[model samples]
Target: MKSILATILSIALFGGFNDIATVNELKNRAKKAYNSGDYEKALGHYIMLTDSLGVKDENITLNLANTYYKLNDTTAAINNYSNVLSSKDRSIKTVAHQQLGIINNKNKKFEEALSHFKESLKADPTNEESRYNYELLKKILEEQKKQQDQNKDQQNKDQNKDQQKNKDQEQNKDQEQNKDKQNEDQQQEDQKNKEGEQKDEKEKGEQEKKKEQGEEDEQKKEQKPEEQEGKPEEEKPANQDPSFSEKLKEMNISEEKAKMILEAMKNNEIQYYQQNKRKAKKKKDPDKPDW
Candidate 1:
């Protein structure tokens, strides 16, 4: 630790009176060479300032890191930047920390890079680049977690929807089968009623035929010439027949006189006769009205 401190102090307080001016001149030349894309020439001049002149300035260290960075020596660049970050100079601390983090990230040392970035933020919280990098890493982690959760939710929802669809299909199938059975039952009932109506009609026709035959037998048994003659003369009429009265009885009239009157009214001459009899009754004296 003492040798390290002595080495660091030797680099800080160097040889001659014009030592800083000479180191500054070399640094300017190095910058011009680096700007002109002569990375090897710039690296040689920067190494002369840090090693030979013992001028371990933060700017010179940064230049050395830049030189190593251009040479694709990421580990050397990261080490130099880390040394700049560990210095007592508070003015360049934030920039040094941020650069160290970037180099470490370029080297694929993510945890070390993260540690450096956190130190950078602690040094200067308002550093836009460091803050952005920190927040970006945080956002990437959060997005990964959210993507995992979304995939899980989508899988669960798909499973539930499939289950619901299966249940609905089963219910629909059952309902369709029930409806088909109901239709078949209705058809069977209708066929039964139709057969019953046909059988009733057939029974009614048979009864009618039997009644007609019985009536013919009764007519054959009762046929005496005198009995037939007794049913005639007054029971029938000259222009009308007794069958008219039987036809009137079949019409469901209860009064015999009303049935005869209705039958007489159907004939034009009999209607004229009834009207004349009513007029004659009206013309007769109440006390002397003939029966």
Candidate 2:
């Protein structure tokens, strides 16, 4: 660090013209080289003036920037122009800002270029070129901003339309789903009702069957006295019941058929009695004769 400081101090303190004649001669040669369009030779002379001679001259710095710009060394030109910005001479500062604006404009930096142009006009307001550049760039930037806003508005409109369409589609889908669900529920309820109806019919049929059996039992009880009438009080026939004729009447037999059935039953009784009488006659007395 100390070495760097010492080197800087050495150049600043001692690297200058010891006499006026040598300095004037170098200045004439640099000017002549620049006027002849020999930028390389002019650049060498300018570097000698600023770096080797350590002349703190703003004009030398500005000229160096011009030469670098002519050589298409934009980085070096910008550095030199920035260095001249702090100059006390308004003409030099205005020229620096103008050059910087031109460089930035070529690189498509509209805002920065316009700012530099405005600064250039502030330093030298009577310069018509700076005024024109500032007005033109400002108008261009305003038009660009307006176009961007219009495009943004159109884009928002399109997005809103798409969103509304999607919302409507979703609503329709939900409505369709609800309709299908209702249909399914109704079908299930109908099936359940049909099953309930079938069960009720089956129960009704069973109940009617039980009722008919009860009525038949009551009818049989009511006919019991009729079947008992006209029977012998002493004894009943062995092979025939008194209820037999009633059974035949209940079978829808004609009156003639009922009499025939009664006659058959009476004949069976007579045969049974004769058989018992013959058995009695065959029995021998204990005190009577034996064969």
Candidate 3:
């Protein structure tokens, strides 16, 4: 009876120690898988250690939440992380809140993510990673608003510039057309003036030719003698007193010499005074004059 009691007591102690050893072994395997980035395998082991190995293991629950987050199962991760939060462990709660915020941000739940980050800061005010992500998201939202406003301003400016350019182009086109019309009118006026001048010059030329012809005809008429068409010469008697002389006798000029001087003057070829002196001497001394 003493031996059987000792055997039973040894078996109970060993069984309790075996349960503790299994819990520790499962936790170690989960840790190794989590560190190696095998989140699915790590999550399985962590869950087993927490739910089946023991219900009072806070550390395993936290590790299980982190493994769920690594597996991209945000819902499960949040649930396990909330379990850690209910534990009232400040360090674990802070870490769990931080991880929950990151998971919520990844799921496009910005409001929930912000709440978790704020709660984390309240738990540990010096959490640099939480502070940085919060400020970055705020800055991104503000910059997006500023960029939208700037784009609207630039679009308005472009439209106004286009309208002003069209106005200026139209004004310039009208001015150019007006200038061209003025130049065309000036050219037409110049042509009309030139035609008038040509007409005047042609009329003046005709008048001058007619005057020159009339002057030539008058000069020919003056050069012709005024002798009658039908007349005869009469015989004259010799002068007995010789006191009254004829017109040619008074000038003592020969008839032949007088005729020659008249012909030279009519031809307009007499160039010297000697031609006139010869004619004057003939008229003054007709008896001594040479024809």
Candidate 4:
């Protein structure tokens, strides 16, 4: 213990110690702090040593990564662990891969975690932790893929259902439009028929009136000329006698005047009858049926 203390004191006197011995002393101090669970002290010492060394020692980088992980500084831990992957030591590379796999799994990067675990196993095939984690991550990836496929299928089915619904709606709309068009056409046809029927009835009525008028004209043509002349004959009293006395009484005249007027009328009637008899004889047919 006293010799160890003497060596430490010699290393601390920077001017007396060689650079290699000083660096070894720093590494030893950092490792002692880390083993004692004084991660903050170990981290500070390692940082100072890395700056002095001007090189990333594999062991120091690995210890820094572990310290960062313990401090819950995932970004720093991941960066340091990645640097440790370049170490020539297979053990260090295996541990780095394992830590990276654990970090990626925590971040929900299952595929990347699986890949890291596989790389860890390749680096050290006897790493039980890496092998177990690899199998577990593989199963998780498979389950995630299956879940994604189910979601995709469900989306496709929903899309198809929506398309079919839209198609049916459009079809129904078309059918309604056609039905309305058909109704309009039928209404127009009915209106046309109604107008035609009314026109036919008016024409028929006019024709009947014309026919009756024609029949009346023909009847008038068949009548005697005198009858067509519209002359009205005097109506004599059925109970009266055609005598001079009766005529005088009907005229309310004196007997003498009535006798004189009757004489003049008799003369005029005799002359009119003679002229009419001559006209009738002149128009007599030579070839005749006596009936």
Candidate 5:
């Protein structure tokens, strides 16, 4: 009976020690996997350990958050990191806040990231990485705002230049139109002057022709009376005289002798008158003085 009790006590003690050894082995395997950059294997082992040991284990929770962060799983990393913040260990809480800050900064949540960094500094003021990141984000945001303002100013300057160019072109067009109108008016004035000169010349030529016709008419009228004064008078019949017949009866001559004597007398008278008229025309008057 004594041998059987001893055997039962040894079995119970060995079982307890074996259970502790299995838990330690599991922890060692998980850390080895993480160091080797096998995040998937580390994640699996950490999940199993947490499930068996309970979720309230701070060290297990921090390791799980780090593994998720390495895998780029922001949601799981944030959840596990948030759980680590409730740990009583000051060092663990500080590291948890710093991790949350990095995740929020990567997502461009500036205000949330700054809040996490501020909390991390409050827990442990000597964290240089958090301080440096916070200052760098502030400077980047300021530079982006300045660049936007410069682009807007350049756009306004280009608009003004275009407006001025259009105004100058319109002014030049108006000036050209005015110059063309002035040239047209000058041409019209020159044509009018030329037409007036032509009309004056035509009227002067007509007046000169009429004056020449009136002078010709006056010369014809003056010559007509002078031509009629130069004509000779017609002679009367000698037989018709009564004095010649009376003389013939008084002489008591024969009819044939009387006719012969009358013919002789007529011939003598004609010859005497012609001789006297020639002497009068040929002889210059003795009473007239020589000039």
Candidate 6:
């Protein structure tokens, strides 16, 4: 590194002396600014050396990549680091791969970062930092794979449980519906039986009423001999009063002497009534008291 810088500084030829001095000055400023944590200043100086001055040195490109990384510009940093990867210098390859691994790791590209770390280690077997990164990232990926498998198993178990719960709920709902239907059917059957019983009772009551009315009508027919005979009687003579035979029939008398005795009793009752009427007529009001 010293030999190359000495050779470049020693070449103070005609047209390129000023350019070479400017490039060296920019390189010194960029290095100092980066060491002092002034990434913006370092980025400006490095950009002038690499882009403006057109310095094609891989070491300068590596320095520019480092400056960009310090400025948190991972895109430009990765671009410069990738350019350094083609350098024949094993140390530069190691650094370029290590920087890419770090950038990829920061962006959570674990696989690419691990691959870069492995390449960094391959480029320089003594790079303990890259080896550490490779081992750590490998463990992290393995743990992630394990966790993913466990999560998938748990998710499957939860899905099966939910399906079984839903099935049980559906069965319970069906059972409840069936039970309600049975209760409704039973209620309808009970209602039908009750209505049938009520109808039968109503018909029985009507039959009893008809029976009672029929018995009353039979009694009335028995009392009225004409209606019992179902015909009008023949017209009689003008004397329509009860005859002696009817009287005898009323008295339940079969002998003619008993009928004569009933007639004598009737004549005596008439005489007694006439006598009582004459006594009532003789009963006069008392005379006014003599004053």
Top-TM-score candidate index: 4
Among these predictions, the greatest lDDT belongs to: 4
Model 4, residue 102: C-alpha shift (Å): 2.5
Which ten residues in a row are the worst by lDDT in model 4? 230-239
Candidate 4 colliding pairs: none
The sequence of per-residue lDDT tens digits that candidate 4 reaches over residues 1-291 is: 344454446657875434776777778887887899988877776776665455457888898899899889999999999997877798999999999999999999888899999999999999999999999889888898999999999999999999999999999999999999999999999999999999999999999999999999999899867444433334343335558567667889777785576567767776776676567558546588656
Reference-based TM-score, model 5? 0.45
For all candidates in order, the CA lDDT equals 0.74, 0.80, 0.71, 0.81, 0.74, 0.81
Ranking by lDDT: 4, 6, 2, 1, 5, 3
TM-score versus the correct structure, for each prediction: 0.43, 0.62, 0.43, 0.66, 0.45, 0.53
- TM-score, candidate 4, is 0.66
Give the TM-score ranking, best first.
4, 2, 6, 5, 3, 1
lDDT of 1 at 242: 55
Candidate 1 weakest lDDT stretch, 10 residues: 230-239
Kindly give the stretch of ten consecutive residues in candidate 2 with the minimal lDDT sum: 230-239
Q: Which should have the higher TM-score, number 1 or number 6?
A: 6
Of 1 and 4, the candidate ahead on lDDT is 4
TM-score, cand. 1: 0.43
Over the stretch 187-279, how does candidate 6's per-residue lDDT look in tens digits?
999999999999999999999999999999888867855334533234343235548567667878765676466567767776776676577
Each candidate's number of clashing pairs is: 0, 0, 4, 0, 0, 0
Residues 76-112 of candidate 3 have per-residue lDDT tens digits of 8788888877557777877888888888788877878
Clashes counted in candidate 4 amount to: 0
Tens digits of lDDT, candidate 5, 1-291: 343244335435657423665456556767888889988877876776676444346887898999999999989999999997867787788789889989998898877887888777777778877777667766766676677778777777777777888888888888888888888888888888888888888878777777777777777677655244433233334456767567667877665786677678777776776676577569566899764
Q: Candidate 5: what lDDT?
A: 0.74
Q: Which pairs in model 2 have colliding backbones?
A: none
* Model 5 ranges off by over 4 Å: 1-38, 49-53, 57-62, 78-125, 170-291
Candidate 2 Cα errors over 4 Å, as ranges:
1-32, 158-166, 212-291
